[model samples]
Target chain A: MMSKFITLLPEELHASLQNKYNEGFIYLLDITAVDYSEYPQAKEEAYALVYIIRHKSFQEHILIKTYLHTLEIETVTDIFKGANWLEREVYDQYGITFLHHPNLRRILNHHQFVGHPLRKSYPITKGQLSYEVDDLIDEMNNRLLSKNVVCRLESGSFSECNKDLMFLNLGPSHPASHGTIRTYVALDGETVEAAVSEIGYLHRGFEKSCENHSYNQIVPYTDRLNYCSAISNNIAYVKTVEEMLGITLPLRAQAIRVMLLELSRIEDHVVCLAAVLVDMGGLTNYWYMYNPREDIYELLSKLTGARLTNSYMRVGGMTNDLYEGFEEDLKDVIKKVQYGVEETLSLIKHNRIFHDRTQNVGVINAQDALNASMTGPNLRASGVPFDMRKDTPYYGYENYTFDVIVGSVGDVYDRVMVRFGEIQESIKIIEQVMQNLPEGEVNIKDAAITLPHKEAVYNTIEGVMNHFKLTYEGVKVPAGEYYSSLEATNGELGFFIVSDGSGIPYKVKVKAPSFTAMSAYPDIIEGSQLADAILTLGSLNIIAGEMDR
Target chain B: MEINTQTLPLETAITTRLDDAIGWARESSLWPMIFGTACCAIEFMSAAASKYDISRFGAEVVRFSPRQADLLIVAGTITYKQAPILKQIYDQMSEPKWVISMGACACSGGFYDNYSTMQGIDEIIPVDLYVGGCPPRPEALLDALLSLQKDLRTHTYNPDRHKDFKGLLDDV
Candidate 1:
């Protein structure tokens, strides 16, 4: 296992966590809990709260686990501001209460939902519906009054207001947002006094669903994590499972996987850039961006079976080999994509309107961003050059020569420009993969992991038996636990898996990047203009499927 | 109140039933209120792209407001948390409106039938069409629009009340 687990007492969690943070563990990767009450190997403890922290310099992951006798523990929110939502999610799922945590409410499930749905005792099909909307009036009012700001934007003067602070609800079904995020902002004139966003509208019990499903069946569910870059989620899930099974896929599979990862990365960036631009009243960019994106979809539809959600990864390898003449088509698409990117660049690079709107719009200082545990391009946008591909070197990323794109101000402009820079670098990586494409069997030779051919199944009794056993029992993942992550579209989309020598996983907690992004949203949007807030939200690319999942 | 066909020029002259003319008008100039939440939203964007231009049907004007829109394309999964919002949006749309449930998830909750996800959105709101696929392709969305258009072309309207204008209450 990549992660070294350290058992801790509940009393020592706060002190030890502070000690580690002092010892250069600046990044908070994820906070999740495992319900081991029903597991065969578990001891007397009913709940185990796991905190995965990392060193600021590199990917030195440490898994600190503390078993809770009861459902209460000290909150680490004071140390890590991002722990607010992470703790709430843990509490919502496992019913492990965090003591002295401010505003510890249901983060993923509705407030009306009863019992922690992720508990082994909770029924999978028992669902509850909430009729009343949770207006975060108390929360937003405090944040607005506590700040006590006296001034406004640098160029504009702050006028004394006669009217009360106007509360505005922007989403949960607004046109500006992605239709899942709801933010209630207290506005003074056009400036936002305070804002509180809520998610979980699309929380379709992904973790609960993963527990009931076998390893292979869960691939399709991961496809919806960040549907724009679906394959990256697939790779993130399958890679963890593959590591647990100790299977080394052929070199050909690794090359193709990297290629698809870069391709999807481009696709994700294009969608983000185009959508944010359209928010700024530039619909022409959507045409330019989506044209190449649609061309990429054309190639992907041929590569995978589906257009949007391609569940193309198996345990040890890709579902199938790449079609012949794929390189020609891929190269052609890349050229067109580059041209489209250049057009958008010429239109946006020195444009006055875009610069004025995005330059200092939603600024989050590097310290606040790091405190909130932001990762990927968002972290990199704040001038942090930490990339999983570079730091961890998964899928032979170290072998490729490309820059880890960074930005200075960490505003909306930097965020958009960083994605544009990354799309170019991804093209470079894809071209490198195509140049030295490996030639070998995609799947590993292990009969236990790979499915047999149709001819073999009909002709041989061994094949029939093996297929049946693998179908019913699933690929036998040796009883163990591992946390593996990849550089997904948003951030470090990690899968923390616990297996118990059974067909189903004991627990598979997704460390979705967008969740962390949402945790940092109120901080980013506060004290900014409402119009700029909309642009900032779009620039953040808060995909609800991934955020809620 | 009939026009004189002999007085009108052949180029501009046309004759059709009022119901058929109303159906054609409703089908042609559809202002779609897109209720997209997940992957199908991305596909909807693809349909807005050049390869599969949805503007060709005169349905390009995607009004986020329920009051302005005539077609409701409910795309992606709607969980219990979002059920009330979906119902409110459905209720807000005016009469003579149509609903097209766009993906498997919207049609029957797709593969996610668990504690959080609803079995189908139809449990809360009536649907006119159900496009199938994990996220039915951009072309498939276009096909559903066309099918809905076909239904609207022959839909029997009753001015008296909503009772006579029977919807496509089939198991979509």
Candidate 2:
């Protein structure tokens, strides 16, 4: 449905990607593939790799498709550094070999995992064992050799290389890791000489689940992807499906979506800042942050039935109309959260210890951040003023008046500061949504797309069948593919859906933000102190549910 | 029934069966090691935070290391890749420990019955209690701890014996 859907041969995949990068299409949005082996419609090619790249401002967007004869293709990591993880993931799922890929082993699955699960030929429920810890020492030694630092590890000998330098496991269960990521760091006294981050501990096969589930059933899955802000993920998933269907939602539904979206963004920022502050040893600010999140959660629980995973967004529109006096509750919570944030942050924002731990410790410039495909608050903190809401302008975001907040320094402090500013701007957008509240039915007018009312269901056979089919099978989307992204809490939360003119999607590739952000961890953490590395990871806000999905 | 014999632990002298006294002591101060891996982690924090206040029930000393913890609260989804680590943690915990499998995923892989996901965390490590929800609410998690506490109140001391439980496939 988007522009520039050109097909290329595997031989030209590398060169074409290079040519695009040379022409200022530097922002590599995503690299995903669909296994056509299992599509309902017969296809010539077994697989088609889709590349989404954009210029700096995201004005001239390009989505290229390349068919593969075999499960082998040239790796594009040289042109786009962000292609490293994306390529590895493709290799992991589709078993497509990325030639010259730096570390192209299993990423989402353990090495013990046998077959590529994403391929249609592969069985869905064939479980595997997850033994064997990853070998990060070889890579650590390689980096140390490049640095000319004395390599403590000599032929796998644990001969007390140096008392000062040691290997430490920072997570997967540690307090600072927020219980998900495992960072293996070779430490030189207090400084980290090399680090290798191992994720996928929470890879619960979210995309594979999408392959079997209906469009509506996947909403709860999206909520788990970014649990901090469930609605944003919900919006991204539904927006992609709605785009494929070519349906325009009612004005009131759009307004309500924007309202919940901004509220979710504020909640996400609050949680990220709270966790980051906790990592920085500012424990008091956590309650200050969490209290506001609880308020938002309470508000959402009333609107939707669930708290953390609110499956509130239907494909065509919202599930329910806004309750009466909802506007008053929204405004009151916004005021309370704003005041709470300002009052609590003021205590530690200017504190010397906080500044010392965060400032200039994990510095990343704009170019490097963009090259790594970072987005949202982290990329903005690196001084890029790119926002999907402003540039792509989805769901009537253009009408809202809010600045794209940027920071000069790309460190923990700047990331925190950017989140703080963005929270205020989100509040501003929510206020705007309140001002432009239109009165109308929330669900669309079409009966086939949306379920009929209870009264209608009880009275007519058509309504009864409609309710039954719609409830169980979900709305059928046309046979086409669309890549839709939105500015989620962490970054660009993208969903690339390949529909087969049925309820079940052919392939759903989530270009999750935390995955890319966490991929850039080793690059920025090597030269920093051990303490700063923890703060840097927390600042990135790598939700394992999203990253490992 | 008296839970603690005295305000100061050293000066306490109480007459009771070894099992009853030890069980009361174990249930009263359950040091929980949270193996949090997904959305359920957030709920665990809420339960641990100011609102739910998990410390009120004595399982609030959140420890990451298994050796120091008396209870293993497996709080989220345990995938195939993460199952070994979960088993290692469960194996490394101090003796007389209990495992509270939290969330639907931890109990039975929830909605994701896929290639990479373990059918349930109990497939790798034995479980004492299972709480069900996509992500069980904070209250549900608290109630799980309380329910585990009721079970813990009858724990008998055994130096050479472990819980008589085995996984479906424990080799991994």
Candidate 3:
């Protein structure tokens, strides 16, 4: 289906959104701002707001575009609560203000940071004066005090009540928090009365960097996002570029890509499950799962050079063909992973303490979860069966037979169960791919896009010239914009690229799943105890690299 | 109750140096702070796991609190927003602390040479060891730990060492 872009005036945004909401576009996927100041065409406005909305029932998606002549624009947070962080992120990067946004503050950068980084004029390597802990703490205290959002506790004694009600800073360094998310949790006794999560500690300016790097150079950077499943990020990014280039993969390449993606899914699930179990005091479970994780890493290392940051995918294909004995090694490792999954299930699935800690904890209902634009196992755990692989088939995923695991109660337990079930399904998919592994060259034969084989480059002069040109000039993508997404282990990892017919992308908006999922933290952990909050956060599997990026 | 070394037989003396004994004791038990920031943290976890067990090196205890930790494995990227927290954690740790800048990001910002990432964590905190890799393998981290242990065993601590040492603030 073609995407219809409706350019509305700032005043007409609300009504347009209301109309779209009535037309089955109920879910707002992403909100990003693009600066078209330097472009030759599209000179009508300096900054354009791009919104990606999806229909759950009809499975139809559309891109809503509106130019902002002024810095201010109407907010859609009233219509979609998930727009809270997305709009803040847009404001933070582009200096575009949302008029009616409740907490219209910086989401991915320090409040003291000056100038919008995503603007075409902003330098990529410019560093700001770092804030001291005292400065940040004072700033937080001021914000809390001005908002008057602190809650009071009612104990027998006034002094006891006052002491019981206090703000506790959870992270930016705390181990329980998977990444560098600093949350200001106002606690009444042990219960979290209110929590406001502050991100951007690990923000490396990914979008800004994408503007500087060429199409191929950005592949390595994509590995840094959701490093747990670097291959998935690599594939998702390369797939987006390929879509813009109108390149199709060979059957062998497609099969290899499916295997790698499934392998990454298993690795990500194992880490998520093991981390959650460890946070809940199940240290043995962490050991049980890490063994298989290491094996998977070894398998990945055998295929690609690196283990964690496997920049394995190229523009039109992969970096290398599957190594000899890869299938045998994969079969052996899959068996070990299956055993590890079973062992973990037997250990924690029926354990009394595991249920006590996870069950009924961080219960986010289906409507709230969808409102937050939650994806991956987190969304499925909330009883919404939305898997991008099943919904939008890619890489010949429609040929595979697997179940989309769903949970009735979206609690910590449900999240863990869904991950466990997905891991099993991934193993099954990998097995199926191995049974029907295709035969052909991994990289496409396009001299302009794909790299020539090393043997050809060494032997032939023409091959040498092509390789030099491809490396130096990079793949020239046609001038266009495309939104490509894949069912990443976390959720829907989307890459929206606006190409100017040049090597470098004009705008690269990464709709990180962890970023959206972590936005729901405050709502999920509001009335939960501190211990339960930690467990729930662990269950969410918020990776700071992707969240901040 | 003790006999003089000169007067006692050569076989019975068995004398040992004080510095050697102290270094051995200190190097034998290096409690690392569990301060992992990004991808390298995963490799760090794998190093702590069963396969590539770090307990054998006497660096197994991954303490969450900065006060109790002696070694800071600065894994992953340290952004401008996180640089202060890293310094605060390093300052909170008691004296005789060591740091291992794991991964390319912590070593020299890796590929993220943008506004948010710090060029290297060494700019904020003094790193004793630097491990190179995008996210260095578990084996690389273990090697860094062993080398740090070797330095602790061999090098003598001098009060004047701090005088020649310069930090990122000097450039700032």
lDDT of each: 0.87, 0.85, 0.86
Stretches of candidate 2 off by over 4 Å are A1-4, A150-164, B2-14, B154-163
lDDT tens string, model 1, B1-172?
2467888788894768888888877878999999989889889988878889999978899999999997899989988888888888987999877888988888888889899987888877777788998898889999988887777777765334434443222222
Worst 10 residues of 2 chain A by lDDT: A154-163
Place model 2 in a CAPRI quality band.
medium
List, residue by residue over A65-180, the lDDT tens digit for candidate 3.
88888999889998888999999999999999999787787878777689999999898999885656423444444444543543223652223224456778898889888878
What is the per-residue lDDT of model 2 for residues A449-477, given as tens digits with 9 covering 90 to 100? Answer: 88899998999998899899987887888
Q: Compared with the real two-chain complex, what DockQ does model 1 have? A: 0.54
Off by over 4 Å in 3: A1-4, A133-163, B1-14, B164-172
How close is candidate 3 at the interface, in terms of C-alpha RMSD after superposing the true interface residues? 1.7
Q: Estimate each model's TM-score.
A: 0.95, 0.95, 0.94
lDDT of 2 by residue, B69-141 (tens): 9889888888888877788788898677788899998998888888877878877777778889878899998
Candidate 3: deviation at residue A522, Å? 0.9
